[model samples]
Target: MIRKLCIGGIGGVLCLLWGPSGFGLEPFAPRGELRIVDTSPLNWLSIALNVFERLIEIDIDGNLDPGLATGWRWIDDRTLEVTLRQSVVFHNGEAFDAETVRLNWEAYAGLRQPQMMGEFMNFKPGSRLEVVDPSTVRFRFPEPDGAALVKLGRLHMANRQFHEEHGWGEQQWGMLNKAGPWGTGPYRLMDGFSSSQKRSDRIVLEASRQYWAAKQSPRPQRLVFDNTLSRQEALQSINTAEGPVDLVSELRPVEAMSVAQSSFAEQATKRAALVTVFGQLNMRKAGSPWRDVRLRQAINLAVNRQELLGDIKGHGVIIPALAPEGAFGYDAAVTPYPFDPDKARQILQEAGYPDALMLELIAPEELQTQAISISMMLEQVGFTVDLQVLDAGAFQRQTRLKDVDHPPEQRTWDVALRSALDHLNFPPFLLYHDFALDGPSDWVGEEPELRRLYEEILRTVDREQQERLIRQMERHAHEQASFLYLYNPAQLYAVNKAVTFVLHATTLLPLVETSVTDAHWSVRKISGQEGASETRSAQADWNNAEQVALGEKVYVSFCAGCHGANLEGQPDWQKRLPLGNFPAPPHDETGHTWHHPDQWLFDIVKDGGQRFAPPRYRSAMPAYRDMLTDEEIWAVLAFIKSRWPSSIRAEQARVDARGQ
Candidate 1:
């Protein structure tokens, strides 16, 4: 016989068959809510909902894994075949087939706007994409692109049905007014998503019950991202025993170290990212000194990398070329220009600048300090540097001087400091995109050798030969001083000790496998028939005398370490550690525990430090979700509040009343 069971609160049922041996049924369990703070906007809410599907995803080691397309093979030097995953359904209920793939790529190619993904797809005006079958597609490129697979990893598929019905652009997914561009991912967007062009500061996503990998999807009931909190605010929240954030990522080096030893958080560091910083010169300007290679070299030589790196702390390393070590085309033999002011002066004098030469420098606001330091260094060798700082947006506009709409007179920036990722993980793409004639950022206009090397690198098929060509290209660019190479900064993040998190190579948060292990308050699944009668309601008041008496015993067992037996907290609680975190504070009237509402305190005890802090903030609080029952936690809160004098307790009651 088959037995059917329904899980209440959650709309789902499971079936079990009775055999001679036994019977079993799968049940849905509630995972606690998660709060995260990220420095960069990932359009994460949309990504979480699986509203779009990329062809490939990068693993933690920076290698590609199949995403939507299960397998791929090269048909020829310029032809490729992709085998799609079968029977996948978009969030909107549309079937994801080869035809869907065709429409999405076509839409991307036909869009009038230039896209970052377009560069990787290598789609041109007449490129051909043919549907070989319902589950397979073939792509024919105009030319052989060695990095084709790498580039396709970023090609996100939009549902063709939704696009056609909405009529494109204005009605496209991710727009503030649109409901979706449904995808085949593990989660779905819940209500209350606020959008912004710069970054969506608030987003909420819920795990999809209908997800294809439902059995393996993480236990998180919901994921929340808030980017509006300032560093100090996040830090403060993290130090609070019951603050609301769960994780903070992309922290600066100093901030990461400040709370490194705090009991509030655990620091996880990835020492390298496939990104670099560099300085580009305007070689196209008429009568410009940068047109002379020797002068550019002198400028590169004048700045002291060691001193500049010291200012950056432990964040980065100076290199001679744009490519980071281990990437294709990086040449170990090519080194950065040694800091020698006298040699730089001699080179500049030979290039006809016997006296001080004046030049303009443009840098983004975030890099203003370093730009100023470099300017001072350049001045020491007889160069007059006029520094101009702009917000990130304005700086990017200035860098796109080669665009047709930009006013010709406004392109007066002589030197621009910029940062970028080697997204394709190949050298020829960078050399061609930034320095070749008519290249995207062709500030250097044209270089015959670099162009020749790029074309040769493209034609070569052997990985060994290709790397050799890359080294030659790197050497050529360094010798020409194509760009003043800087360093690659380390990536950092801070996580709550309660949940396990493994970082991804492309920096995507791995939430699918996340779960509640030793948390203080694990959720209990309630059967539909017995839902209301199983246990006490989550909304019960915390002032019950009996519950308070029970809570006193629970607290002594679980929370008496850092909080002190008398609830006085650790000494010097206000003092911050070198890593930037504070000690545990008292729960009595002397501390600020009573300043929060009951719900806030409950969330802190349930979620721990990650719920209230930014991704970089550190803390020592461990979540009690797995260790304590709701009644027991309430009892503990009641016991603590009973210790407060009537005046303080009354004020806290008012705060809770206002919150309601």
Candidate 2:
């Protein structure tokens, strides 16, 4: 019939026959279309995990898994060779290969792209990719970097055409444009929707029929992410039989409770180990009492983390350090500071603050309750607390030295309550962004020991060695009371009972792995497990006996004078010589030579210590760049590495493979 039907109309009219459900629309089906409530219109979480693909994927337990690339190996300590998966094509019918990777890398290499983990997601400067063939590519770094694969895991791959049209990252609504959101994932951002319309309230995605993995086809034919609905409204929608919403993330405790009691919906919870809420003391502030170790310890002792968790109704674990449990380099031996107000007062007295000590504390506006609780605790410990809360934007600006309007010397806050996400589960990554000398924060001022330890950690890649170094750093931070260790927050999600969802420890919702049961539309159930995948080890270049023998001959001929014939150096090599430079260090297990990757060792030998040494740093070591060829330099390093114990050799090899 040619009759026009106006459905909740402002201006548009539809010419269609009315259906039983009304307006010719079918009833909401969880299996056919999945509606998720998101607070942000960008929907970055879904875009990163579902709409696009990376070179590698990290599982729930922080294990690296294959994604676009099938397998990888370390060509050298600074070069990673990856083999791309064949027969994979993008959503726009573009083939995925080495050229596709190169294009994506070129688009995002040096740009400070906005990411969930901040600017650390960008590849280090001077990092480049080389196409070995159509199916193979190699990544070459300026230096030996241990977090190469972890960084690659965050590189979202789009087709070459998409890169040319929209560029990389969220730049002035570029990613949200209607032209394309072309990717090589199970789903693709549905077109025909204007960027302005999508930015205002909603985004739509559809399952890709031509996705690479046929068996892992997306269950939902259509997916809608709407930000117009509030969490409360989303909860209400889920409780109804034919409501629009099927899933909601980041629910508050009260909302989770409501979902738990609802018959039509259920609540899913997991410990978000990657995100942490902690307090940073402004010990570097000029003439601040927090500079005193005793005062800092007193502050740590005053706060009751368990009580804070209880008050907030949080079901997360209290951490002893910034790093969470199960994360790489996390030490189980370290324990949280006990809550002792009396001890805190005593320490305050010992630190020459016998009377009430006045201090200023600042935190984000969202954490007002936490800030009040901490202030109360400090008040009980004979401290006069001046609590000032700022909005998220202002709080971020004040916390970062570069963004703050005031100069470093003019900063007046004594303590800042901050939150950080160690999404990679790697402590060194966090250290580089927050605690290093060149970091955004001024909390670690003139701390040579901490800076040195961080530098050493950056150069190391062996799991065991990195753990030892990180543990030492943790212990140092703990003993020094560098921060107010807090609990890891638990993330809660509300879901319609028809969907079977699994939660990851990293707080990533695996929508691709989710499924809907048509028979049980109101029966609630949740299940998940954590496991690590086996990683392949790289073959050591020093394994050849001929290379080792040749290396020994070269080492004795050119290096015997100062380094000793048996790989031993002069006594007291750790101490500086009279000329202000240290003597040659031993290459055996007793020295720190094996602590570095093979590339680092080769560079130090080939270019000599003088060129690589710090400014004005005296060095007795001579350059072999003119005397020795590249092969000779490599052979010498191989020979030196071959003399180490099997354990040391294995550790070095592990360091080498970290690049892959």
Which candidate leads the pack in lDDT?
A: 2
TM-score of 2: 0.69
Which regions of candidate 1 fall more than 4 Å away from where they truly are? 1-30, 39-51, 113-122, 145-147, 164-181, 192-201, 210-216, 230-232, 239-243, 261-263, 402-412, 424-441, 455-469, 508-517, 520-660
Model 1, 1-660: lDDT tens per residue?
A: 335454444533544444443654432443666667765544442343244556776656566678778998878877889999875766544568898888877776676542432243355556678999998999887877666665566565666545665534521323323334245666544433433354455655555433555445546666667767865566555545333666777666566665567566667666556667778888766666688889889998899988887776656767778777656667778877799999999999999899998988999876776788889999999899999998877886777654435553446778888766554566566544654445566688768887787777666545577789878877878888877767766566776666566665445565665654445122333122223453434432446778777878877655653576789976788987444566668988899999988888877886676579765454546455544567787778888998888999999999988876
* Candidate 2 local lDDT, residue 656: 62
lDDT of 2: 0.70
Residues 1-660, candidate 2: write the lDDT tens digits: 223353555632333434332433211212356778865333454455677788888777666789999999877878889999987777544678898998878877646663534565566789889999999999988887767787788777877656665665543212445424368787666532323134536666656545666545676655677777887788788876544788888666556777766777888877755667788877666776776888888988999998888777866788887777677767789988999999999998888889999989999865677888999999999889999999877887877887989776567888888667565677767643475455677575766676777677766545567778888877777888777777777778888787777776666554676666654322221111113342332322678888778788777656653566788975688877443567678988788887787677776785568777875454546455434556777788888888899999888777766744
- Model 1 steric clash total: 32
Clashes of 2: 0
Error of 1 at 645 (Å): 53
